[model samples]
Target chain A: MKFGVVTFPGSNGDYDSYAAVRFAMKEKVEFLWHKSEDLQGCDAVILPGGFAHGDYLRAGAIARFSPIMKHVIKFAKSGGIVIGFCNGFQVLTESGLLPGALLRNNHLRFNSKFIYIRVERTDTPFTGVCRKGEVLKIPIAHGEGNYYNFESDVRKLEDNGQVLFRYADASGNASAAANPNGSINNIAGIVSAEGNVLGMMPHPERAVEDIIGSSDGLKVFESVLNYCISPKPVGRL
Target chain B: MTTTAKTKKVIVYVRLKDGVLDPQGVTIQKALGQMGYPDFVSVRSGKFFELEIDAGASDIDRQINEVCSKLLANPVIERFSVEKI
Candidate 1:
């Protein structure tokens, strides 16, 4: 399956995501320009990281209105596969493709480090290859990764099993200390209600190679590829 | 009758919804406490935007409302108020 990595004007992680799919995953990949309103017939779309439109007003407020985003939103609503990482996650939430909002880190500082996140649910296409509760080491770099939502929406997300990843310790305990950005319930990643769209703060694409430290992130990419190869009805979450 | 276009200003205020955590505001409150201003009641941070529009723009209120809801504030955690200034 071909992967489309979107490149907004200020997107710095576009190349990284492209390399991960083209070289690491050995898959056909193309760069989708933000101003273009086309998906380029890709099976999956990746809204890679970086400060789009200079992150003015909010991290993703401007980029969410990009021309390509209109198509991205339509594509996602039609049950297409979309994964957003870092600033990409912010855009997804701002675009209403994902639930909740990302606020400034509780400590009001930009955090950059390798953190462990446990797969909360393996039913989604993004985590299909991982065992339930398995811990994956990934890097998170952001200033506003703190996730927030209305109390009722949080309950709905939990009930629907949409919460997919939570920051955790090596032992897989999602303790308060392990919560990197103080996301409610340590939520590091989540899938849309339909389970076709995923938004996560951590850069799984940055962790695909062992030489870079850990290859735990490759599992996520592989799971998506596997799901694409054999299309099946996804469990609503 | 001939009408000339005039410039009008609209002010928009955006704030996080109640119960939503405001880390920047919290940090400011903490700093205030450290500065020996313990009596400070509270602090909540917010943002605003000033827009200039044509005075004769049709459905000006509706246009401002749409902009506020669609871009100025994120409905999930923020609320926005618009006023013709």
Candidate 2:
């Protein structure tokens, strides 16, 4: 199947993401520019990370209005596979494609580190390869990476199983230091109501290659390809 | 002859609490520090703004509160209040 990786003006991970998908799944991947209204005959869309629009207004505020995002929204609404990382996650939230918002790091500083994410659920295409409580070491790079939302929203996420990843220590215990930016409920990722749209603060592309030092991210792409290759029920995460 | 006094414009600003990272503000402050001699001790940042709504004394206060909550400030990590000065 053909995978579409969307590129915004300031995208830094478009190539990394494309290479990861192809290497991990041997899938035909294409680059869709932010201005393109069409996704160019692709089955899935990946919104990679970077400082789009220099993150001027808000992290994902400006890019959410990009033309390509319009198509992305349409694509996801029609049961298409959509995954966003870091800034891409910000865009998803800003577009209202997902719930919650990413505020600045609670420590009031930029964070660049490898954070272990304890998988809350792995039934979605994004995490299908892993089981519940599966641990992943993905790198996070952003000042506004703290995930925040209302208490009602948190309860809804818990009830609906929309929450996907939570920051954790090696022990898999949720703590403030492990939480990194003090995300509410230690959230590191989430998905939309339909479960097709997945957004996470960690960069799977950056983790796909062991050369950069980790391959835990490969499972996410692998799972997507696995679903496309075979037919499986998409589950909530 | 006396002219009606021009109504003074009051402005209010809002943003994240002190413990939050303001990346944009940091970048701007760094640029400022790089220009030449650096004497600015600390740089805390927030939004700048103005309001021109015409309403009763109580109504104006209520409208400001509404606007801040609805648009100006994100309730999650921000603390907001208004000033008339």
Candidate 3:
């Protein structure tokens, strides 16, 4: 399926996302500028990581008002596929397409390193190719990766199986030590209530090739392709 | 007769909700303790914005409130107060 990677001002990871889709996944992909209101008839969209609009006011706050986002929001609400990584994740939360918010790391330091995350659920389109409880080594680079939400909302996300990935050890233990950013419940990634939009702090695009580090992230893209090609009734499994 | 709209300056103060965690505020509090200000038991960091709006516009208060809630602050984890000077 064709993918549209949006490039907002100061978006540094757009190229990485585009290359991952075009070269690694061997899928048709195009760059959607922030000002462009068109989706270009793409099957899926990716909001790559970066300090959009210089992260003014707040991360993703300004970017959410961009012209392209109006269409993206409508596309997502209509059951279209949209995946956001890092700052893109922040954008998703700010746009109200996803629940919860990303906050400053409890340590007040920027973290950039490889970390392990366990697949909490594989029923969603984003993780269909991942095995239940499978741990993937992925790198996270962000200062405001700490995720926060109301206690009641978090419970709803958990009850509905919206929590898709969590910081974990190699053995698939979702322990506090494994959580690099102090996200509530070690949540590294989560899907929307409808399971069409995914917001994750980890940079899976950077891990698509083994030369960089691990190829486990490819499974995420593969999962999307699998679901789009022949979508099954996606519900809590 | 054409009339000019009056310009009013409004201030918006934004703070994290009472129970939400504020890591920057915690770090500042730690530094304050180290610097011998033990009496400063708490530090909750926040930000403010100054806006100039058309005072003659209809429902000026409502407009300011809308901007504060929709842009200046995220209602999920923050609360905001508006002051018209």
Candidate 4:
């Protein structure tokens, strides 16, 4: 499976994501710079973490207008799985690829730690490998990760099973201790209406290495691989 | 000899309105009080943007207005003011 990791000017996690894909799936992952409009025939794309554009303006404001973003948006609209992590999530939000704005952390500090996130729903392509109620430990580092959307939108997410994951304790119980950023409704991540594009604040790539601690994130990549092998429809619209 | 060029400074502050709950501001105020700055007053936080644009052909006022309205302010709960300092 060909994976494309988009790199913004300040993107730091694209390399880590490349390494993760190589180690787990043994594939020659491609690096798609934010400026390049050409994707070079990638099956899926990932927007990795880091302070894109030095996080100037807003976290993902400038990066959302990158030339490649137009292609990424179309790719996602065509039923491609465009998963965004950390800063990537911000970009998706800014570009209207995802809903909800990420406000400053409720704690008013940068959070960097492995926190438990329960699989709130698995009906999407990104979370199909994860079982509902399964809790995975993922590290998050960001000041603006508090997700806030209109109450109607939040309810729609819950009703449609678009809320894929929530911060929860290791035992799979959801609570403030598990919710790192005090995101509204404790939402750690969510998917688009079609369940193809997902934007989440947690870093799943960092959790793929066993020696680092728990590799619960492998489940996410594994789910992607399974999706790749599965007979995906021809091309995106 | 060529003359040096200079641009005016623009200050834009975005703050939560009255009656709005600003958890970040509250936390900072609490922390300040805890640090023994008992005299510290209320702290309502917002964004400060310094924009330097080529005011040659474009309308500076229009550009600045677009920047503030479209990007700087969320327009839902936040208010902003821009001044040339």
Steric overlap count per candidate? 0, 1, 0, 0
lDDT of each: 0.91, 0.82, 0.93, 0.82
For residues B1-85, write the lDDT of model 3, one tens digit per residue.
2223578788899999998899899999999999999999999999998888876789998898898889899999999998877
State the fraction of real interface contacts model 2 keeps. 0.26
Model 2 chain B: lowest-lDDT 10 consecutive positions: B1-10
Q: Give the least accurate 10-residue stretch of model 1 chain A, judged by summed lDDT.
A: A228-237
TM-score of 1: 0.96
Candidate 1 backbone overlaps, count: 0
Tens-digit lDDT string for candidate 4 (A98-212): 8877877877789888888898766555666788799898888888898877778889888877778898888988787778887878899988877788889999989987788
Q: Candidate order by DockQ, highest to lowest?
A: 3, 1, 4, 2
Error of 1 at B82 (Å): 2.4
Sorted into a CAPRI-style docking class, model 4 comes out as acceptable
Error of 4 at A1 (Å): 2.0
Question: Could you say which candidate leads in DockQ?
Answer: 3
Restricting to chain A, the TM-score for each candidate equals 0.98, 0.96, 0.98, 0.95
Candidate 4 local lDDT, B1-85, one digit each (tens): 1222455566788776564456778888899999999787888877777765543636878878888867786544467898865
Candidate 1 fraction of reference contacts recovered: 0.89
Candidate 4 segments whose C-alpha is farther than 4 A from its true place: A231-237, B1-11, B16-23, B31-42, B50-62, B74-85
